[model samples]
Target: MSGQQHILEFRFLAEPTDVNFGGKVHGGAVLKWIDQAAYACAVAWSGKYCVTAAMGGIQFVAPILIGDFVQVRCRLVHTGTSSMNLIVDVRARDLKAVRDRLATQCVLTFVALDAPDGKPTPVPKWIPESEEDMALARYAEKVMEVHRRIDQEVSDLRPAGQDH
Candidate 1:
């Protein structure tokens, strides 16, 4: 889903070190980029340190080959008392073919933290100033709904006698 008006762009070149012997970039490498991009976006929005609280809906749609240039784009999707939701999309550009394709997508949850004590901190409310921005906000709401249901289902499945 689309998110806030501001989109943060992060780019990296995939080298042999980032790839497996099969020539595809490792999933762990992509995940690290996603988290870095998401954290940067959250900090840009909140102007504070942010820590990852959770992540969801990680889907790998395409493979990134060695020598591909990878780009991660992130945007704030939702906000709560001290947390912000970010959606990040990872794409790979084939320098040889000059083609760009989506490789992976994920939703990340981050909480603003006080620098002094690493306590929970508040972030500014996401204000959509245009029609398109408002539409993204609506999409974020829908994503949040799905996240809530999934969380509830997981909670319900836990053994009654065990601590979750």
Candidate 2:
């Protein structure tokens, strides 16, 4: 664990129960892990409970088979008055290999909430220091715009006062 508390990593085994019909870990299962890891990072950085406002560009490059070791790594890349952006990377390692390979990656936006009423609340500012941190922040910014556009497009597809 880093003393700065900017990043967090969680490891889990891809269980048989998580497998899809094709015999690989379900993409939704991996997404759930991503959300959990990002929430952990947001809660740690904001020191408050958080809600996922949006997710950006989840790219599943490789498959995670059952019995493989799954690692979800999350880091705080950017912050606003009440919104926090996190970059989450998922990797999987076979039983025999020590090194993990990238399986999925995405950026997510979370909103810190006041505990009593679950209202939006401000969070501590996160200033990127390292080059990697800066790059990730920039990437998050770009992805956020794309996410917003996609959300708008989806909303346009839905009728007024109706949920999709």
Task: Give the poorly placed runs of model 2, Cα more than 4 Å off.
Answer: 1-4, 160-164
lDDT of 1 by residue, 22-140 (tens): 88998998999999999889888888898998777789999998888888999886778788888888999888776799999988888999899999988888766788766766676
Candidate 2 lDDT (Cα, whole model)?
Answer: 0.91
Cα lDDT for residue 157, model 2? 91
lDDT for 107 (candidate 1): 80
TM-score of 2: 0.92
**CA lDDT scores, all candidates in order:** 0.83, 0.91
Quote each prediction's TM-score. Answer: 0.84, 0.92
lDDT value, residue 133 of candidate 2: 85
